[model samples]
Target: MANKKRQTEFLLMLDKYQGTIMKLCLVYTDRHPENVKDLYQEIVCNLWESYPRIRRKNNIPTWVYRVALYTAYTHQRSRKRSVPFIDLDDGFFETVASDSGNEMVERLYSLIDRLEPEDRTLLFLYIDNVSQVRIAEILDTTESAINHRIKRLKQKLKKMNENEEEQ
Candidate 1:
């Protein structure tokens, strides 16, 4: 029965946050459906491994974010060296097109892909309105450090945008 209860909790958590995981996977995998699906499964497996330790409070997403992002980062690094880029079908683009007003969001994600992985996590949390202090806790850094890094990231993004416009 203990195992059953844990499964129930895990399923509930999965149902609630799978979209976020998918989005994170999309970010890390560059919208490649095959890679995104693989990352999603991997993140779910990692979350299940840690599920018994997870708290169900409002901070559930915080813990999930840490696990998901770390898994994405590790997966990216491991695959970066040898993964061949086969041409993917544009099925994901079809979904994007059906969702109105998401073209800018897609373009923003492209810009974000240029950032360092650590900066990407920070930007993801900040854009989602996670408090700097909470982001510090999630990322195992100081609140002031999070703030400073975010400031630097903003300047970097701004400069990139300026340079792009000049072209």
Candidate 2:
């Protein structure tokens, strides 16, 4: 009974944050809907398996985000070779095409897609409104290090955008 209650509570908590998880997956997968769905399932499964061990020692949201990020990164790395450059399904393209946001969101995600896995993780956390302190905790880096990386990423993204504009 106790285990059932705990599990129910955990699922409820996860349900409340599903949108955030989906958004993170969307961002991490470059809006590739199929990969987004895959990553979402992987993240949820990881969180469910890790929930019992999470305990009260860590912030649940922070821990969940960390797990999601790690899972996405690992999945990306493992599939890199087998995955084609443009493997997005029709649904994936539809989601991206339907996005009402200005070109900046698309451009930003394009730049994000170009980053290395770890860099993409950092940028995803930063964009998710996660605090620098929380991001540091998630990435196992100091806040100063997180700040530095964010700065450098911004500069690199700006340069890339400029190059794209000039092209």
Which has the greatest TM-score? 1
Q: Which has the greatest lDDT?
A: 1
Question: What is the alpha-carbon lDDT for the whole of candidate 2?
Answer: 0.78
lDDT of 2 by residue, 1-167 (tens): 99999889888989888877877777776465666767788988999888889767448878888788788778777667566455555674357435658788777777777887777788887777888999998888899998899999889888877998899
Clashes of each: 0, 0
Q: What is candidate 1's lDDT per residue for 1-167, written digit by digit as tens?
A: 99999899789979999778877877787666567766777899999998777656677878998999899988898778766565556575336323346689878777878888888888888887888888998999899988899899989988998999999
| Model 1 whole-model lDDT (C-alpha atoms) | 0.80
- Per-residue lDDT value at 63 in model 1: 91
Model 2 CA lDDT for position 51: 85
Q: How close is candidate 2 to the true structure, as a TM-score?
A: 0.81
What ranges in model 1 sit over 4 Å off?
55-58, 82-101
Off by over 4 Å in 2: 81-102
What are the Cα lDDT values of the candidates?
0.80, 0.78
